[model samples]
Target: MFPGTEAQEETLMMELSRLVQEQVQGSSWWELRGKDCAILGLAFVALAPGFLLLRSSSLLLFSLGLLLLGVSHAAITVKGAHLSSHSSLTRSPLLNRIWAVFFIEVCGAFSADAGVQAHIKMHHAHTNVLGLGDSSTWKVPGLSRSLYLFIAPLAVPVITPLVALAQLKHQPLLSSLRTLLMVSLGLWSHFWILVHVSEFGSTLSALGCMFVTRNFFSLPYIHVNIFQHIGLSMFSPEQRPKRIYQMSHGVLNLPRNLLLDWTFGHSLISCHIEHHLFPKLSDNMCLKVKPIVSRFLALKSLPYQQDSYLSRLRLFFDQYQELMVLAPPITELVGIQ
Candidate 1:
């Protein structure tokens, strides 16, 4: 019902911007960089004991190793790649590009350029619009919820490289080759760690170790991606609400989890509405600015979507056919021009 005029929308954004500025006071971007650096080192820290415990004969120690490996992988892919994709970690564009290639292609096993094209250019730009950022894009109607929610996620680690390679056909040959080399390097390094460092009994056993470790957190990974965006309002391009209205209505924030908060960052977790509203701000800044954003939205009588993680999970489980397997109905919406 808001966005009665273009002036109204602009006024909302201007005041919202001032509120965020007051909260941040130009909070240090370098602090974001340092956090990313620490996140990168999470791999080494986890891998040290992870592989050691994995190589031991004890089943409990091996399970612990599996968990650590999954944590490191999530830290790198979810947080590391996500931050670099947004160019949130550094002021230097060149260094940002370097980090993208390192975290996205090397550590995350995905193409950096493709990631930017998809996540930034399309997803962020057109959230909830049909054929653009619709949460339904992830649907696999062929697979039942049991397979998708439980079994299929285990294949994500295996499928990510293939998907990245398929996206490279549109890219320049040099760029594609770089993506290929980096993805291969990532796969091989994981394999090597299990084969050499863990000294698995056989090649198949080593691959099994890699698969389990890589996918240790995959269930939550897929769950988190869907929980925030799916079941929200969907709009057509022509009828999309104003930017503020669109984002506030379209995004949902889930409560924090220790592993998810650290690995996915506070942005993708508890502070998601703020993240979508100000993607340029790092998680630290997002947290800092949340109170301002929340109060402003409340005062403006605007939507600030928040729901529990389990509640969403239950809803999706109960209504998977409507929300995930089928294209959602576009909300009948009109906003300021």
Candidate 2:
């Protein structure tokens, strides 16, 4: 239960929890595991062809292959790395940690441990808190809007690995070394495949391909990261309310989108309120209980923020200076005191 929630809101929370539990009870463990594994397997399958096609002499085929690989890489990062970091992909903590290291650190080219600290421990724990989880991952203060939108996103793939390396300074020596080794091996293995298996004429060309493919969808990725939270209310640490209230007011769900939904999962895209309410629930489970949660919130007269992606884009462009350039002000909810 959230601290300081009123009796009526508490009751609504209890009812919502019951409905979610009932929905989850009908799901099978195998089905959950199967879906996650299938997605990861598909990502690998997508990347495999890129290696094969890279060997072709045709530049068009090479570019097409790189695009496919890039999209698959982004999908794995979103659906696999993000879920595993939250321990929502599996019930076992060990398995979740393993997946995080593999998917986030290795394939996604970022630190798994840092992701847990930043995303799960910080972001989820303090959603929309000023200086905290207001989806500040892609912030580029003082940059021109055009450059911020176009050039900055393309740098994410390069910046990710560097950020991982920087994070090592704050970690224990042995653990840091281990992560360093794994990250190096992961990056080297991919490059080796490009050179040997893909038969890229030169290492420079292979490196260029890596940069292009890994960051192909970066613009949308960054947009989605900011779209859900930036324009919403931001609260100070002391002013933070109960989970349901904070999330409903702060998180905005985008309309149904095939690419965003498939890559980012239902919670980040469509069923955000349900997700913020039940952080432990899997993405599939979030989608399942979305209707129940939505109805319950509607009945309780709570905010269930939803917006179209295009509309958000327009709002962002119109208010870029106020929303992105400057820090957002804290929102004081009426009757909260």
Q: Considering every candidate listed, which one attains the maximal lDDT?
A: 1
Candidate 1 stretches with Cα past 4 Å from truth are: 29-33, 335-337
- Give the alpha-carbon lDDT of every model: 0.83, 0.81
RMSD of 1: 1.7
Question: Each prediction's Cα RMSD?
Answer: 1.7, 2.3
Clashing pairs in 1: none
Error of 2 at 4 (Å): 9.0
- Residue 77 lDDT (model 2): 83
Model 1 C-alpha lDDT per residue in residues 1-337, reported as the tens digit of each score: 4547877887898899888876667666555456656766766688789888888888898888888888887888888788878878877878878988988898878899988988888889999888888755457889998888888888888888888989999999999999999999988988887888888879899888877777877888888888888788888887787888888889988887877888888888988899898997777777778888989999988888888878988998999998888888888655543
Error of 1 at 186 (Å): 1.0
TM-score of each: 0.95, 0.94
Where does the lowest 10-residue lDDT sum fall in candidate 1?
27-36
Global CA lDDT of candidate 1, please? 0.83
